[model samples]
Target chain A: MLTPARLAQYVLPLMVLGSTQLMASTAVDQQIEQLRARVSAHSVEVNRFEQELLHPVDTRVAVFLTLAGRNGLEVDAVELFIDGQPVASHLYSKRERNALERGGVQQLFTGNLSNGGHEIKAVISVRTAKDQFIRRESVHRFTKSTGTHRLQLALDAHAPDYEPDVTITEWK
Target chain B: MTGLFHSWVSAPAIKIFLLIALFCDPAKATSPTVPEELSEGVVRFALATGDITAALPLQDRLKGDSADYLRGRLLLESGNVQQGLDTLVQVAQGRYHRGEAALMVARHYGAEGDADESRNWYQVAAKNGFGETRQKARFALAELQRHAGRLDAAGKTLAGMDEGYWTAVGYLNLATDFARTDLNPSRALVSLRVALAMCETDTNRERSKELKSRLLVRAGQLAYAHEDYDKAIGFLKKVSLDSYRTPQALYLHGLALSEQGNYRAAMQSWHRAKKYPLAYPGVEDAWLGMGRGYDLAGYLGQAGEAFLAASAAYEGERATLRELEKRIREAGAYKSLVDDARNADLEWFLADSRTLTQPRLAYLLGLIENPVTQRAVARVAELEEMIASLEQQERDLTVFMAALGNKPSSDTQGRSKQLSADQDALTNAVAALSGPNISPAQKRHIRELRDALNASGSVLERLSNVGGGNNQRQPRKRQAERLRKQTQSLLVEVRAVRDEAGKALDRLALEFIEQEDQRMAFALDKTEQQIAHLYEYLALKKLDGGKP
Candidate 1:
């Protein structure tokens, strides 16, 4: 109902009826450009919003699997349980194992938790350089507060002895 | 059909429709497609996570027209607009999405101010595009011609575009062109009349009535300018009382009645207008006109009293305008306005004000009617939608992430078991070759087998040998991690841009309010002048012994 001409005519009296400036030709085009930018933006925001809503910062607990050193402790699979409820389990591809070998961190799990103390159990299946298939399970205790909690589950087989060990450390 | 299966999912229609609908439909038909080499589920998961970058490499694995279209879409989505446009232009040469691609290219060039290129692509789209794409291109081409002052060309472009809603829109645009150029006022009126008739008859679109009201007001204003008071009155009288246009229509109707020497009728129109809020555009003018009508009709005492009432209304409205100006300065006011405008769609300024909850905002109905303010409001509404969509996505992504590792992929499990078996075989072979119990002949036979195995280099050998120098491909897990980080970075950038746009909108809102405040101040000045003029006439009459 509020066409540009009507508003213009209402604002100024005795004006030439056709003299009200039309909306700029580029107005819709500019709006389209803005929409494109918004599309790209919203695409990114979706993930961020999902992260917040699904795993709220206050109660979010995340576990990441990373290899600490260049020891041949090839990860075959890793399973994670929070307070004895199975949350995440993945069988690794050779390519995926190489990714971890190259210092890539894989997010094992992300879930909500109650405040205070919680137990995280990580079960890792690894193939050593000696063709030994070993299954290792480790448990760590941490506190979930009003902030995001990140736990790093590392397969450390560094220099010196190069003995492969599965360890879970809470990220401060 | 395989190509169709993939291309259909990436079709511009589905994507654009999804965007418009905000993807509220839970039962989605199309999903992201990957080549047979890559996992379809992984690509879908990547897209669901908004990690388009992670899925981008899979585009290399895709081929044919579908591949080109998908590549163009991903590139465009990832902000590679130039590449995306080029790729789409290539796709435009093919049957798949040709019309859609052509239209998009036309719009891109049009936005870039390349009128010749834009027109060429628009023509291409009109010829090649099917269904809605063709119609949209024709409309856009007509608008381009209209904007360029090519009335004849524009009319020709819109000649056969008699498809109801779009046809009405076309005529309206053409009328606007004619009115702006003043090349042919009669034709402009004709076009508006035709558009008004079309709008009246249009039943599909909910906005037809709103458009009809706009057309009436425009036609009335045009007729009034041409001194066709009867025609103006006839048109203005049809404007619905509940329409946001009613105040302006009433004011114009009063002027038209007075021009025809019907002062009593004019006074009635203005008197009816006085019932509306003074902040409504032209309502204050209506108040002033009513007093003037009384004076013209020789109701001297009533004229003086009416003038006093008009001035008081103006003064009271002035204070209210100040408060609205303050309210506009706050970002919350724009947010509230955006919420009200959620269902406004294309009619940002024409949104029903009666449904508005904010008293301060309701008063700015006249101000928000400005096209500039409307555009700003529309942008804010779009931004708010983006934010809301983002929140929904975040929740959805959490579920996706949580579900990502719940089960091992069958392919991976099968491969893992095969590798373990192969490793056992290799281990047993090596032990058999080295054992002291083995005869020399048996050892040689096993050695020959071992040599044969070593020559082929089985899956177990390759997997066990981590430092093998040949494999250079980046792993999927690493790519996913990189995409996640990039997404995090993009989130920061996008948020900053959103905030900046929001601030700009706040400034525009304040400017609209301030302009309204100035307008109210001017109206108050005019009313005060009317009051003084009325008293001067009254006193002069008393001095001449016309009244005690």
Candidate 2:
């Protein structure tokens, strides 16, 4: 009773519409998830020596971080910051002359600590094997000693790569 | 010797230098303004030609009105003292970078060793800009104060530095500046410690460690002065004075060792000190230690000789040191102290050992006191007369304590107490007088001044022996105490002489060269007289018109 041609047209149009809708929905959902995960895996540490950042008269100090324990964690980048502004950043451990470097033990960067006290924050990125990246922020604090003071940063895969952004209103 | 010295002094080479200085005008001394193009051209020329004289052609044309400061500087470098000063003065009046010119003048005065004048210019320079010129002026002011032994002023000047500029060297210099102050030894030590701490983890730099050692030595000396001998020794033990730190550190270490009653070690230190130039700053103390150690060890002759050498080393510089040696030598101690003091200070301390002051003072005062202590007193007198050259050294613990009436350092209390205990020792010595009898007035004056110094001198001597604690080989500081006493007596006489000379010289000198056409000279002389008047109005102006 029905022609073969009419049946084929009607069936083909239906199949095409359904497949396109499914693909569009899947892609949109994956993109939203990726954006959320991008900031989730990263962690941060903040430390402040003084209520206000202290600047030593003429001393050289550096910020340090450790990346040993976090297996399956891929740290794409790290940012060192002072008073909310980025001072230095490392990308994929490539050879660069941004700071004075030493092997293995820890890196010493030449920069002055503010005199009274300073709050330093480390913003790091870590991505899982599945590419699930999270951003984190941690803080360390210090006061200027008549002697040298140390700042230590530890990295762990157990932490997320991204954290909610914090805004600092005042800096000294 | 005279011929060699004369040849060096009157070298024919100096004539050429003088001629050059007189005739060489800066070729590029003229410029209307420091036009960028012109300044660049001149710099290129200077750096290229390397002929400092080629800059002279611009001199008068410069008017010191344009690139005036540079012109003034060139003029000064060319030996046109007055002209440069004039041009610089005009530039300083203009609103340009004259602050730098003022500093240039200050530096000029400093090189000439006129610290006071240098300070005046530096102060004016400081008001100019907030840049390098201002910072330089501050440094110049601090240095001048330091040179004048006004340590407080130096410290105050450096206090303006923010935490950002506490360079290691600056910190060390600041410590040194504060070390010479009325502030106690502990404070000075703290200053040095602060500097040391600031050096932090920069251990790879030689300057950091080298300066630390230098600071440690200074801290040791201060602790020694403060009677914290143990602490002094502790700090001193931390470093070796291997390089340039040798003379200064080793000397202080020896002082600390002597304080600890480690005489054998102290003597060794002193012997080591002797290998350097004799006239070096701290060598006087080394001589004292050497002689005193020998005395304690019963090598009386050697002790006396060492004392004489020490006395000579600081003859005009430290009147008390010289006098102490003379007295010990004359004390009938079976050896002569004057010869040793003279040998140490004169023969060893200086490249040129001139005996004009020590021998003259001793020769004039010999046979004036009791034979028993005459040897001692003569050494004391020589030491006292030398104070003019070592004025700063005179304001030590002994002198300070004497003025303040503080207790003697623990080590010397017994000796100082015993030395003053028996009137019989003094009376017996008086009986031994072979010279003309001294009038009661002179004796009283001498006693007043000498006794006035007793407290401080005793303290100073005691400090030389105090330690963390030890006995037996507990070397006595009595030798030092006795010498110090003798030194006090000598100072009394020297002060009297200085006062007399000062008064006489204070009179007018404009009459000496009153040539009619020399009105300029006459005016200059009159100004000098006015300056003297100004000096009298002020309590302590340190005017070269005559005042140490």
Candidate 3:
């Protein structure tokens, strides 16, 4: 039932079609990859523009949030105020809370602050292991200099007190 | 440090890269090395941000294998591909992440069209990697060899790479390569049989089933085309009834049977094919074939009835196709096309049967599943994304401009005077150093400083002249305004390109639908012609008073 020589003559077109289809698929794949790379590169350019021009180093201030301890303090929400003006606020999703617990630092807010004394207030809501809800407020006053200032809010809940100890430290 | 950087200034690309690294953010430049205890936290932060430029300085402070791996990744992310490949090669030489690094290097070389290097790196990845990575490398290596027309090598490379989808696909591709290049049907059939066996063991159940059906139909068609009735029948008979290729396989099987003088078996195959939707491949042809089979078997009454059924089905199919063509023209089908176009799956063409089976879209499956149409549709989606990104950049610039307006005037004036004073001082230093009293080494040092200063001065001039700002703040504001303008122009260009791409997709879709409609029309004409032949034969027999 098998005739190799004659069958080869008959099936040549089909083989050509199959190879063309495969090559077309590969070409499409390459085009999509190139497009993805171009988009990524464009995004980086936009980010550079934002960082260098829009938010100049002389007046830029970044606020970062970090969880310092493994105590049973589950952050529900955190709201930030600068000079009594509402600036940044976020309600923690389970995933975000887990990331914070695993030593991930979140940049809560970044904006320009003129060279002068400014007041920052952080209102944090937390849930204890016993299902008790507690709200705590921490205020810190720091003078913004003519250079970039990065502030980190370290929230630690130790066993003895389990009070939300908010320590505000500047990176530079 | 200044002299080293100054020497690099001769190369503009390196200078620009170094400038971004050194001056993009003053905070990074001033910060001390990250503490060992804090490195993990910093790494997490960098990963969370997903910004290569932002995390670059951290790479300098972080040590060990993970940091090197991240540095390689960051270089790639930053679009410094050559540097990234070099870094990855170093990482591949290390004990940790060697397999992963080698995999990356292989992929990079593959994309760069360095086939030999790509093959070498793929072998290295296959040797060092475990599980998925090793399988992927082997599959890619096989693909590269096949593309290079080295069928035997491709097959050997795929010999023992896992028993899953990739391995099965490799064999299938190898079979195709053999057929196209060697034109050896025997070898191709052997490879196809192996591919089918591999398909049965593939973990991806749905994909394997789909691929198996397609392979069976292809093999059957090849045999049938060569007049090998028994082989064709054997292959076609194995296709599952519910498979996407069922109608095509049945039609081909009937043809093979009829050629073998088995009219009853042929009619049965055609009847089974008719039970499928008329929109399916070969169903219309099968309907006509059924009528002819009955006529040839001397069942006149049954043949007449079969002709009537075939005519009715063709008329209905014609009506449905006309309605679909009308809808395509009215853009009612545009949304569906766009939705399907966004499918990023690599095997989308092979899997399109699932989507095209919808009642409204079934008849258009041939056109929609076409690779050219899919490519056009995907291009349209990509263009839309580009336009969206440009618009987002414009919005960011708008916000930045608003902030610029609120900046204090005193700060602006002070910075402007400082830059101007610095520029004047640098110019005076260069002039003073040009005197003959200077030592040769000192003269060369002065020349280097002058060149670096000249470079900085030109940048300052661009900022000052464009903004018409006598001060530093104006330059920043002008820069934002300039970017906003550039973004707006790019948006216009991208939007125009997207419009053209969208129109092209519409054209391709409509063209496909019209072509399918034309095909059905031709089939209907042939069915009518066959019916007329049966009617005439019956009339001649009745008039002669022969068989009756």
Q: Top model by TM-score, which number?
A: 1
Task: Kindly list the per-residue Cα lDDT of model 3 for residues B366-392, writing each as its tens digit.
Answer: 544565665565566566656666676
Pick the winner on DockQ between candidates 2 and 3: 3
Better of 2 and 3 by lDDT: 3
Residue B322 in model 1: lDDT: 67
Predictions in order: lDDT: 0.63, 0.45, 0.68
Q: How does chain B score by TM in each prediction?
A: 0.65, 0.37, 0.59
Model 2 chain B poorest 10 in a row by lDDT: B508-517
TM-scores for the candidates: 0.55, 0.31, 0.53
Candidate 3 backbone collisions, by pair:
B416-B471
Model 3 chain A lDDT-worst window of ten: A1-10
Query: Candidate 2, residues B4-37: lDDT per residue as tens digits?
Result: 0111223233222222211212221121222232
Model 1, B1-548: lDDT tens per residue?
00111122233332222221221111221121222322332333333333463355455565654667667766765556878899999989987989988988887776466788888998999999887688778878887777777889888877766555556677877887788878547988999888877666656343566566778988998899888888999999998776556878989999999998899999889888777776666688898897899888888778878878887887787777666556556545565444433333346355453532333434546546565665555555555555554444444343344333233346645775686687678867676667668898987978766754553344334333422211211231233345455445545544655666667667776666677668778877887887788788778978999972
Off by over 4 Å in 2: A1-172, B1-51, B58-66, B79-98, B105-124, B127-132, B142-154, B162-183, B192-217, B234-245, B261-264, B281-548
List the candidate 3 regions with Cα displacement exceeding 4 Å.
A1-42, A45-172, B1-124, B127-129, B144-151, B176-190, B219-280, B289-336, B340-356, B359-378, B395-483, B493-518, B545-548
Clashes of 3: 1
Which scores greater on TM-score, model 2 or model 3?
3
Order of models, best lDDT first = 3, 1, 2
In terms of docking quality, model 1 is incorrect
